[model samples]
Target: MSPTPEAVDLSQQRALADWLPGRLAAEQPAILVLGDVMLDGWWSGSIERLCREAPAPVVDVQNRESVPGGAANTAMNLAALGARVSVAGIIGTDDAGMDLRNQLVAAGIDVTYLLDHPDMVTTTKIRISSGGQVMLRIDDSARSVPAEALAELAASVRSAVEHQHAVMVCDYGTGVLADPVRRGLVDALAGRDRAEPGVRPLLVVDSHDPRPWAPLRPDLVTPNAQETARMLDLRLPEGQERVAEVSRHADALLEATGAGAVVVTLDRDGTVLLRPDGVTHRTWARPAAEKQASGAGDTFVAALTLARSAGLPLTASLDLAQAAADVVVHQPGTSVCSTAQLSRYLKAFADTALEAGELERQLELHRAQDQRIVLTNGCFDVLHSGHTRYLNQAKQLGDILVVALNSDESVRRLKGAGRPINAVADRAAVVAALSCVDYVTVFDTPTAAPLIRQLRPEVYAKGGDYTPEMLAETPAVEEYGGRVAILDYVADRSTTAVVNKIRDGEGAVQTN
Candidate 1:
C-alpha cells in the first residue's frame, strides 16, 4: 500500500520542530565551544560602471560590514539558535579582536575563554561581492599563533569543559586550533573510563585535516564532501552508491578517529549522516526559492548540539538539523537562522509538506509582508527563562521578530567545546514554537549585521545591559530606518552564571 512509504522521512521532523521552541520557551541548554575564530568582512553594492584605471568593474560601494567567520561564525550560529553558549578562542589585541568580543557579549555568549593575544593579528576574511553573490575573498592573518597564546587559550577552554554539557572543536586550520591545544582539548573531553560513556563531554569536531584529529576521537565530526575525500584519501561515493560510500567513509572516520558519528556535507545534494550503528541517512536540501547558501553549515551543527542535548534521538536530530539548514541556505551571505525562521519552515512544511516547492513560495510571501523586522539572535544551547523573558519582550516591540542562530563552528569560535546544550534543530524548534517569534535564520558570521541587512528588519533589539550606541547592530539596523530597542533584563539570569553555579554544585547535572 502506497509503496510502503519507502522511508519514514518526517515523524521526528514534527517533534524536532516543536522541541527548540519548547526549550526556548522553557529556558534551558548550555554549550561550550573551543576553536578558531575569524572576522568576516564584506563590501557589496553594484557594478554600475567600469573603473577608469583598471579593467575591473567598479562597485558603487553601497555597504560595508563585518561578522565572525570560521569557528567564531559557528559559535554565533549556536548562540543565535538559543543555546547558552560559552566561547574559548585566541584573539589578537586589536580593533578587530575587540569587535569580535563585543559581538559575542552582545549575543549572550560567555566570553571568559575568549582570550587576548598581544601582537597576533585577528584573522579576518574580506569578501567583495556583486549583488548578493560572492565574487572573491581575501584572507588577512598570520598562520602560526604564538605558543603562549595557545596555552592560555587552552587553559581557559579546559576550565570551561569542567562545567559544560558538550565539547565542540571548530578547526579552520587557523592558529587558534593549534596542535597542542587540539590534543589537550581532546584529552579534556575524552572518556575517563570505559563504563562512563567516553566521558560526559560529548566531543565534536569540524576540522580540515584528519591526521591531527584522529588521535582525539571525537563524538561527532562533520566535513564537506571534499574534506571527507581528503581525510579518507579516496574519491567519495558518487552516483547511486554515494550513500553507501559516505556510510563506509563515516564508519572509517569513526574507526580512524574514534568518533561516535560522522556527518558529511554534500553540496547541491544535501547532508548524509553516518551513525555508529553503520546506518546512513540522507536529508535532502529544501532551500527557499532564489536564496543564497552562506552560513548553512554553522547553523546545522549548532542546532544539532542543541537537539542532542534535548535528548532527541540521532535520527530526530538529523531530521531537524537538516530542516534548520534548509532555512539558512536561503538567506543572503553568511547569516544566522533563528527559531522563528525554523518554526515558519516547519509549519509551512507540515501544512503543505516540503513537496511542490511550497516552501519557496511561502518564504516570498513572508518577505512581502512588509514588516520592519527586529532581528536579534544567539545560540540558546540550553533554554532558560532569562532568555525567554528577554526575547519575548523584544518581540513585542517589533512587527516581526527574527532570531539569527550561530552554527556549531561559530559556537566553537566563541566557546570551546562543551556547548549548544541542545542540538541545532532542537534549538530551532524551541524558538520557532514561541508565539513571540516571527522568523528564524542561521549565520556563520560572528555578527548579525550581514543577516540584518539581508532581512532589512525595521528594528533591532538587544538586552538592557547594552545601549544602542554600543551595539554592533546599530549601523546596519539604522541604515534602513530601523531603530534599535533595548529590553530590560533580569539581573544575573544568564547561561554563564547558571553553568558556573552548576559547576559549583547548585543542583544535579542531568544530560538527558
Candidate 2:
C-alpha cells in the first residue's frame, strides 16, 4: 500500500481543531458500544513493611478509585470525544456492576441497554498500588453471559443499531460475542448496509477471537500485535523489515476477515492503518519513557470511531486517534482523554497553523475557490496593534491573507540572538489565531524571496516603512504578475520599542 504523500502533522491537527468542534456541535454521531462491561478498581497507598505470615508487601490503603473498564471504557472514551454514545453490555447484579453503570452515566453515556444478570458475576479487576507501582492484582468475574440473557441483549443491540451511525463490538474474551448475538448483529448491520448504501452505520470489531467476526465482514478491525499474530497463527516480525511484515500481516487479516480496513497497533513502535484502497498510513507514538498503558487501546478505538463517523478522512482519523491514545498512555492509571486535552496537545505541537507543504496545498485549494491570495512576510515575534492593523489592511487587499513567519534560526541569524523572545511555534500560533490571517507558515530563510516565488501570490503586501526597491522579494512578486501593496503602519507601534520599555522597567504606555 502506498502512503499518502501529505503526512498528518501540525497542519492536520489545525484542520481537526477547526473541523471537529463544529462537527461535534452541529452533527453529532451516535454510536452503540456492545460487549463486556467491567469495573476497574484501584487502591493506592504507602508500603513500609512486609507481611509476617506471607512475606508479601503490606500496603496501607490511603485512597481508592473506580472507573469503567472493558467495553464500558470504550463508551466513556467516545463520550469524552463529544460523541452521542450508548452502551449495550452485560454486567452482574452486584455492587461492581452498579458502580460501573454509575460511572458510565456520569460520563454522559446512555446506559439504559446495560442489563444485569443474577447468575453472572460482574467482571472486576482490582489493583493494589504502593509508591506509585502496582503491587498486586485480584480479578473477580465470569467470562460468559448466561445463556438465557443472550437473546434479550441481542434484541436490544439490534434495536440500538438502527439509530446509530456506528456500532463497536469490543470482545475481550467475554461471552458477549456469543454466536446468536453476533449473528443477529451481523444481520442487522448487513440490512443497514443495504438500506442506506453509502451512509450505512459502520460495523467495527475489536475482538480476541477475530475469526468469529470474519464472516461478519466488519468495516474496521483493530487488533494489537499479539492479537493479530495469534489470529493469523504467525510469529511476530522484528526489525529491518517490520513495517513490510506488519503490512503484509494486516493485508492477510483483512482478506481473511473481509474487513474494509485493518489497524494493527505495534505498541510503542506506533500504529499502522491498512485500507483495501491500497492506502497505508503509519504514525509514530509520542515520546513517553514511563507510562501506564491501561485502557489505552480502548481510547484509540473510540477516537478512531468518532473521527470516522464525523466524516474525517481515514488518514486524519488515524492520526487523531493515535494522538488521543498517546495522551491517555502517558497518564497514571486507566484514564480517558477529554476533547480539551486533545486540543491542547495538538496546539502545543503544531504552533504554526500550517507547515510549508500544507500551506502549498491550502493555497491551491483556495485558488480553486477563485479567491485572491495576498502574501506577507514578517518576524511577528511580538504582535502589537501595528501588526494587527497592517495584517487587517493586507487582508482587505485580497480574499485570502497568507503570513510567512521567520523561523527561530533565521530570526537569530538576521536579528541577533537576543531577538525573538518567543519561539517560532508560539509566534506562528499567535499570528494564525488572528482573524485577518487566512494561513500562517514558518519559513527557514533569511528572506521571503524564495518562498514568494513558490507561493506566487496575487498581491504581495508589506508595511509602509519598506519601499519596493529595498525589499529583496519585490522582483519575485512582480515576476508572477503580483504587485506590491505597502500599507501604513500604526505610528509609534513597534515591538522593539515595547521590549525596550519593559527591559528599562518602564511603565505601560500606549503604542498605537
RMSD of each: 19.4, 15.5
lDDT tens digits by residue: candidate 2, 59-89: 9999999888889989988898888999998
The Cα local distance difference test for each model comes to: 0.68, 0.77
- TM of each candidate vs. truth: 0.64, 0.68
TM-score of 1: 0.64
How much is the lDDT of residue 167 in candidate 2? 88
Candidate 2, residue 22: the lDDT equals 44
**lDDT of model number 1:** 0.68
User: Model 2, stretches more than 4 Å misplaced?
Assistant: 1-22, 193-198, 239-241, 352-512
Clashes of each: 99, 0
Which residue pairs clash within candidate 2?
none
